[model samples]
Target: MLTFEIMLEVDENKSLEGNVELVPQLTLDCVIFGFHGSSLKVLLLKWKGTEYYSLPGGTVKQEESLDDAAIRVLKERTGLDKIFLRQFYTFGKVERYDRESIRKKLAHLVNPDLWYKRPISVGYYALVDFEEVFPNPDLLSESCGWWDLSDVPELLFDHNEILEKALHALRLELSFQPVGLNLLPEKFTMPDMMRMYEAILGKKIDPRNFQKKILKSGIVIKLDEVKKGVAHKSPFLYKFDANKYEEVLKEGGLFFI
Candidate 1:
C-alpha cells in the first residue's frame, strides 16, 4: 500500500501512448497548500490560452487506484514525494462542467462525446513547504505558481467551488489535528504556531490563554535557546516533542489541538 509519501516527478505532458489510457469519466484534483514564512498559499496553474488558474488535475489511469493517480498528479506539478494527502471531498454535480467557458475549453481538449459524460472529481489536498516546491505545470498550461489563499485568481470548471471546499476541509482538519506540524518548521515559536492557526481558523486566538494551554499540553517542549540579534528580549524557541507525540499517538491519539 502507498503510505502517501512516495513522490516521483514526471513530465506533465508525458504521453499515454504506451501506457493504459485514462478512465476519462473520473478525475482527481490536487489542492496543494504551501506555507511561506508568514502566510499560506495555494498552488495553481494557468492554462495555455485561458487567463483562469486551476487546481492541478488529471484523469485516473486505468491501472491505478485513486490514491495512486492523485500522487502521480501531485508529483507532475509540485515535484514533491511522500507528502500525506487528505481526501476531503468529492464533486459530482451533473452541471459541474456545463459552463460555456468550460465547454469551450473542453472542446479544444477532448472529444465532444467524452465531454458529455459527467466528470466526477475527487478532491485531495496536501501541505508542503513553499520554499521546497517548484511549479511545473503540464503541457496544457503556460505557467504555474503560488497564490495567496486570500487572493486566488479566477478559476475554471467549478474550480473555484472546488478550492472553496478544499479550504473548508483544511479548516476542519486543523480543528482536531496538528495540521501545522507538516506545514511549519521543526523548530518555531508559540507565536508562529498561533499565526498559522489563526490564518486557517480565520480568527485570532487569545494569546495569553492559548499560550498557557499549549504549554501545559506537554506536546511542545520549551528550549534553552533564543533568537539572537534582536533589540527586545527574544522569545524562547519550542519544538514538538516527537517522543511524547508518539506516546500520545500510541495511547489513544491526543494533541494540543
Candidate 2:
C-alpha cells in the first residue's frame, strides 16, 4: 500500500514518479498474526500525520508472483523472509472505496482523483512468533507494531472487514490441521501448545482432550524432558516428529483436535 510511509520512506520529497512504476490495479494485503505467550497480536502500520491504521500492504509488481509480492511486502515491513503466507480471500466491494477517511490519509502519496480508484486487494494471513518479529516501519508511517486482535483500533477502508474474515477462516482451519506447529519453538510443553490453540481459536480447550488429540494425531512426539521452574506439576516437553508428521500427511494429510 502506498501510504504516507512509502512516500516518506522511499521518497522524502513527496514525488510519485518512481512509485508509479509499480504495477497498477492489483494490490496485496497481508495479515501477520503473532503470539507472545500471553496475548495474540496482529502486525499493523500507522500512517504519518493521522491516527488511522492499516495492514501492511503493497502493489504487486509486474514480474513477481502474487505469493512473492506478499512475501516481499512482509519482509519490507517486518524484516522477515521465507515465512509462510496463505491466501485466505479477495476483497472487491465497489463501495469499499466510498470512505473518505483513507483518501485523506493517502493524499500525501497519491493524487486525490487517481487514489479514489480502489484496487482489488488479495488477502493473505500467516502465523508468527511475536518475539521473533522486529517491527520495521517504512517512511510516512509513525510506527509499526503489534495490535492485540481484541484491542485493534479503528482501521482504514474495508480493513476491519478483512480482519474479521481472516480470523474466521483461521479458526475453521484449526479444526482440521496443526497450523500453529510452526509458531511455537522446536521444543515445548503440552500446556504451551494448548495455550497457542486457545489463543487462535479464541476459546479454552480441555487439557485432557487437548493432549489426547495432539498425541493421537501422531504428528508430534513427546520428549523425555519437562518444563521446569513452574510451581505446579511439570509438563512434558515435545516436538513435531517430522518423519512421522510427513508420513501422516502423505497418508491423507488430516489432523483434528
Candidate 3:
C-alpha cells in the first residue's frame, strides 16, 4: 500500500544555473469545496493574462512541512485557516509532464527547460464553511472566486484530473465518515442538508426518503429554533453533533445514503 506523504524538502536558495540531475520541487494544491444553497462550489484563481483557471496552490518551502505548506497556501490564497483539510493522494504519472498542449496553452510562462522537469504534485481536499472564508487572489492571479462545480470551465494544467479524484475521495468519505459538517452552515434545515448531499452525489434524492433516513441516524440535533424567512411553516433547524457522529462512524453504525 502506498501511503501519502505530506511533507517535502526543496532547497529554494540553490541557483538554477547548475545542470542538476533532478529538479526537486514539492507543491501542494487544495480543492476547497463550499456549499451554497443547492450548489457545490470550488475555489479557483484566474492567473493574470491567462484564460485558464487554476486551483489555489503554492510550492512547498524548504523549511516548511507539507501540512504547514498547505496551511500557508490556503491562507495566502483564500484567507482560510484551521479548516478540515486532508491529504488523499500523490500524482506522479509520467504523462503529467507531457506538456505539448499545456505549453501552448501557457505559452507566456512555459520554458522548454522547465517543461523537461515536470513537478510532482500532491493534492489535498478541504471542506470549509463558505461564509467563514474571505478569499483574495494571490499576486500571480488577477481574480479569485468560488465557482459552481457544475459549471466549472476549462481549468489549467492537470487540475481537472486532480479535482475528479478529489470528488471521488469525497464521495467515498461520505459513505464511511461524517464529513459534511464543515461544508454546511452551523444551523441548517433538513432540506438544506438534503440538497448538499444531492449536490455531492450529483443526483436527485427523494425528499421524503432523505428526511426519514437522515433523521433516524441520530447524528443531527434538532434545535428549538426554526428557519426564518419562509412563507409557509418554518422548518426546524438542526446541527450535526460531530462528536456523536464520529463515534457512530467509528463503530460502523452511521447510515450512508
lDDT of each: 0.75, 0.74, 0.77
Model 1 per-residue lDDT tens digits across residues 195-237:
8877776677888987886676677888888856656888888
Which candidate wins on lDDT?
3
For candidate 3, the 10 contiguous residues with the lowest summed lDDT are 1-10
RMSD of each: 7.1, 4.2, 7.4
Residues 94-162, model 3: lDDT tens digits: 777556776566555434345466568889998989998887887556688999998899788788888
Candidate 3 residue pairs in clash (backbone atoms < 3 Å): none
Against the true structure, whose TM-score is highest?
Answer: 3
Name the better of 1 and 2 by TM-score. Answer: 2
TM for every model, in the order presented, reads 0.83, 0.85, 0.86
Looking at model 1, residue 27 earns an lDDT score of 82
Q: Across residues 18-52, which tens digit of lDDT does each residue of candidate 2 receive?
A: 64345666677888888766567899988776777
Clashes of each: 2, 6, 0
Candidate 1 vs candidate 3: the lDDT winner is 3
RMSD of 3: 7.4
